[model samples]
Target: MSEEIKVQLTATPGEKPDSQKLGFGKYFTDHMFVMDYHKDKGWHDPRIVPYAPIVMDPAAMVFHYGQAVFEGMKAYLTDSGKVLLFRPDQNMQRLNCSNDRLGIPEIDGDFVIHAIKTLIEIDKSWIPTEKGTSLYIRPFIIATEPCLGVRSSYTYQLIVILSPVGAYYSGGLEPVKINVESDYTRAVRGGIGFAKAAGNYAASIKAQENAKKDGFSQVLWLDAIEKKYIEEVGSMNIFFKIGGKVITPAINGSILKGVTRSSVIALLQEWGVPVEERKLSIDEIFEASQQGLLEEVFGTGTAAVISPVGELHWKEHTMKINEGKIGELSQKLYDTITGLQSGNLPDTRNWTITF
Candidate 1:
């Protein structure tokens, strides 16, 4: 553990919400981890304090320029009364990748993971114990330098917060309808699409809200230039099963490198399942559906884990996948991944970091 992190306990604790009905990202714990950065001092002074609003200058670079990045991770309460963190080191490592892309200073991944475990131990009671419920951990960085210039800021702050949550989708494990976004582009070549930067998400809000207004769950984005190649879903990496093979959008510069997506690929390869990560355009997928070759569709991420996509609505055409229900492969993957997370199945790959 890093001795640099100072701890300040809260004098009066807040009442814990009912774990059964806890929604995603709604309720917070009592404490959070914070660290600061600067051009002169570098990254220093890590601490834990009560969960409260942050006070920053109005002219902060993040407020003006949106030079920020973040990561999503989770801590699960196992069936045997133990706690485990699933691939948190990978998430923190990805956060640094985002920092590099955004010109922000890098934070210590190992120390940050250690601090997360420490904070979880301190507020262990905040972990939801209901089935499909776990503690969602968000680690982020913002440009704190109070400047209005369009250049990179030298000052930054690293923050880690925890939320006790239920399933990400309201209809857990059920198939969801997704609309292919055609109005706005999420990323293009040589853009900041691969990073978990805030701007990428900001660009997606309009399309997502529109999809929601049209009654779809999420928006599947396409590449910026070609406008036909699949990039990624709004909140998750997407997958498709066609002609006895599993294919996903290749990690171009426009797609976020997902830890869950990588793990899924590893598991499929380990089981000798034919899984390919390459450019499978929407035209090809829709054609596959027309020819009765598209078998299943799903999404992978830290929040939803494995969200089965039952219906995909393209431009003036709707395709029903796997009879508008969860496919067999989707169910198996969800069961296996969630099993490994909660220690209900064998974790042969050592992905879960138990604290």
Candidate 2:
């Protein structure tokens, strides 16, 4: 390991995938950024090396107790050959937030961004340039300490990898049907639900799989205690428009602080659209839909950017939002965010950084 980011070029690079059919996260770049940490010495020995499988102890804390955190981001290739990243700073910042929640040592957000940008530059040619494709950046930290105790690990490893991903959903920008989860809970108010912890996603697999079996694209979660108040939809933060007012769940301890969610909120507020972040209940959403006030519903996150919810199935009721069509707001948001990401729209908000 090197004290600084010492780059090791790979002897053989992978063949680039077809841009048109590059499904999500199937292809990876040749190099990755890695760093290690110890309790006595703190975080040290940062380096960029050829991507390879990591050997870990059987009793590694991450495998045993799941003390790990990760961040999801992307790099886009414009028609002019310019590479742009959408809010890399926010992703790094949120990674630290997840670290704090999971009892992992916080990382320097600046250093993480630098390592990510350098890795992207080294594999810049792997970025896809189809109608809807980009290089997916995944930065994660795992506890490497070989312990079985129910406490934080004393050692850690940080790794950043690049994947050439197409659409996160097969529908692309099409609206999706969501099934509300009734049995399982994603996270509790006092849990690591607000953080991007690995266990949070791991715990959601059963419910998500059930939803898929029932012919739904994703699952909508409610509060853990009462299990009635709206929380989130699968991996994304959800939003709705009722009577022309944009509303999303308030940033409670259970909701992950989404970068794209924040951007959408800011854009709506700046554009003078009535936007509110509060505890919105499913009953209220259904009432609004029944009364013809539910104008739109969408989910925001790094992977999909904007996923319109055309239909929602709760308990015994199925509500169609925006007549099962993509709402005007959803379309506009998808166009705007993806436009700025690809340099098709001017980044007036300074959210995109050209690399």
Per-model TM values vs. the true structure: 0.97, 0.97
Least lDDT summed over 10 consecutive residues: which range in candidate 1?
Answer: 165-174
Ten consecutive residues with minimal summed lDDT in candidate 2? 166-175
**At residue 206, what lDDT does model 1 achieve?**
90
Model 2 misplaced stretches (Cα beyond 4 Å): 1-3, 169-172
Model 2, 1-355: lDDT tens digits are 2257889999988888887778887889999999999999888988899999999999999998889899999999887887898998998889888998889998888888888888999999998777778899999999999989899999999999999998766556788999989999999988999999999999999999999999999999999988888999999999999998999999999999999999999999988999999999999998998899999999999999999999999999999988899999999999899888989999888798886
How many clashing residue pairs are found in candidate 1?
0
- Measured with C-alpha atoms, the lDDT of residue 219 in candidate 1 is 95
lDDT of 2 at 28: 90
What lDDT tens digits, residue by residue, belong to model 1 across residues 1-355? Answer: 3557899988878889887778888899999999888889888888999988999999999988999999999899887778899888899888988989999987878999888988899888898887889899988899998888799898998888999998775566989999998879998989999999999999889999999999999999988888999988877999999998999999989899999899889988988889999998999999999999999999999988999999999999999999998998888889899999998887788788886
What is residue 11's positional error in candidate 1, in angstroms? 0.6
RMSD of each: 1.2, 1.5
